[model samples]
Target: GVTAITAVSPAISARQEDTAVAVANVVMFGTLAMLAYPYLAHHILAADSHRIGMFLGLAVHDTSQAIGSALTYSNVYSDEVVLKVAAITKLSRNLCLAAVVPWLTYLNVRAETKDDEGKEEELEGKKSAGGKSVLAYVPPFVAGVCAMAVL
Candidate 1:
């Protein structure tokens, strides 16, 4: 959820209202996941610390929430493996953000640009004037993300 908001916000070309609603949904669902994951791990996934950890790491929307859920589960069940596994899994998932964010941003920008182009063609009967280059559509933060991923 935090990744969605932080990584996607700058690349989003949607109206502020739409972005706000999306952010709100992310936060709401993430909160719910944080609250519910521990109990689900305990009852539904009994005696499987690794599965519980993987489920929490993959299912939770935020890194902190995943780790917190694992910690809560650990304390409740008196098992420390869940915490270790969850942290590793969550951090591994987080590393993908560098690649995923830029790709998602590019796709979003391309889709919006295509829609705009089609609309302009219908109205003007020609290619849009002063159209942005492909390079221009690339988000600025992509380079930094790639650099950090390399490091």
Candidate 2:
């Protein structure tokens, strides 16, 4: 989406730094959540076991991170369940991505149109007032790119 936005509107390129920052924050939080999940799982059971920890990690962790979690439980548990859960979870998220990207593209285009209208109004106001025209900070166009990248 971001890429599409950049392709459509070069001005959005200026927001790449903000996009990177937002992505970094999300990844950092997601990693912390992945690491903390095992601890949370431990308290949910009668007795903590490494196998159960691995299960939670494998089942709940992000698709990319599930590999290590699956390997952790490989010798102790069947690989089938881990693979199934990982694939299903990843598949489900992928399906969501497929649907969401186009919807977001529509939304971004709509927003840009509305913003253009608003900017035109603002420019008119400034012209009438004999003041300098000012440009507002518009969000980056990489929403589509970000959506695609997540998938």
Candidate 3:
């Protein structure tokens, strides 16, 4: 997963750990995303019995994990509904990447201006076009992310 991120996020080339941090954050988010799924599912599916999809989708970061977990759930407690729910919910969580990039871009813009001490550090390499306006170079990946957002 980290290997694949290099192609999408050119900024990751500046620091290898960026890739690790990005992937790890999303995977961890996937785990956390499941936190409310059970409660919601119990209320929504109070009469219906299938919930494997909710569990698999909430816990999984990748399709393989979703499929594997759903398969296991199927053998133990669920049916075809497990696969359907898992696919939809996992995909919903995965789409967060589209939203996350915009927020990171906002933080990046903010960081260019101030630091932890609230002092405006001298920018070493890329100077601002004007003393007042901060310049931003939005990468092609962001265009794709925007397109995903539009969809």
Candidate 4:
């Protein structure tokens, strides 16, 4: 997420750092989601062991925290499947990050160059950077994600 924001940081006009900080904000929510889900599961959903594992796996963003919490849950409930589900779900979220690059790059590029479209520059001499190559915005970490996924 830091990498994703860094990839687009150069293009944003207003709230430039906010774009980067948004990633951390999202991760904060992931942590909150992780902490909140267990209570939600027990009191609200009345979840069983498998669902609890899956809920946590889907909710938590940090792997170590998820694994640690899963271990706690496993010990608390005497079920190992909770740990497995958490690991799988966290991995699944990381895998999806691999596929998000192209679209995110496109959005960043679009936001950067929202104006000066379809004009041959009859008025002002300024031009939007709408023609930036998509490849230019792809972060190096995305390659690591691809390699990890491949391996």
Q: How many collisions per candidate?
A: 0, 5, 0, 0
Index of the highest-lDDT prediction: 1
**Can you give the TM-score per candidate against the true fold?**
0.71, 0.47, 0.51, 0.65
TM-score of 3: 0.51
lDDT of 3 by residue, 1-151 (tens): 2323543454222466777788787666644544444444445666253454766676665555565555555555546677677777866665665555445544555566686798776655554323432224335564675577678
Runs of candidate 4 with Cα error greater than 4 angstroms are 1-16, 19-36, 39-47, 114-132
| Rank by lDDT (best first) | 1, 4, 3, 2
The residue-by-residue lDDT of candidate 4 on 1-151, one tens digit each, is 3444554454333276687577778577756765666566655546476777877766565666666667767776677887788778777776676667666665665566555674332212233375556666566777887898889
Between candidates 2 and 4, name the one with more favorable lDDT. 4
Tens-digit lDDT track of model 1 for 1-151:
6765666665555577877887778678878888888897778987699999888888987788888888888998899999999888887777776667656655665555455446522213322233544344345565665677679
Instruction: List where candidate 2 sits over 4 angstroms from the true fold.
Output: 1-14, 42-62, 70-80, 115-151
| Cα lDDT computed for each candidate against the true fold | 0.72, 0.43, 0.55, 0.63
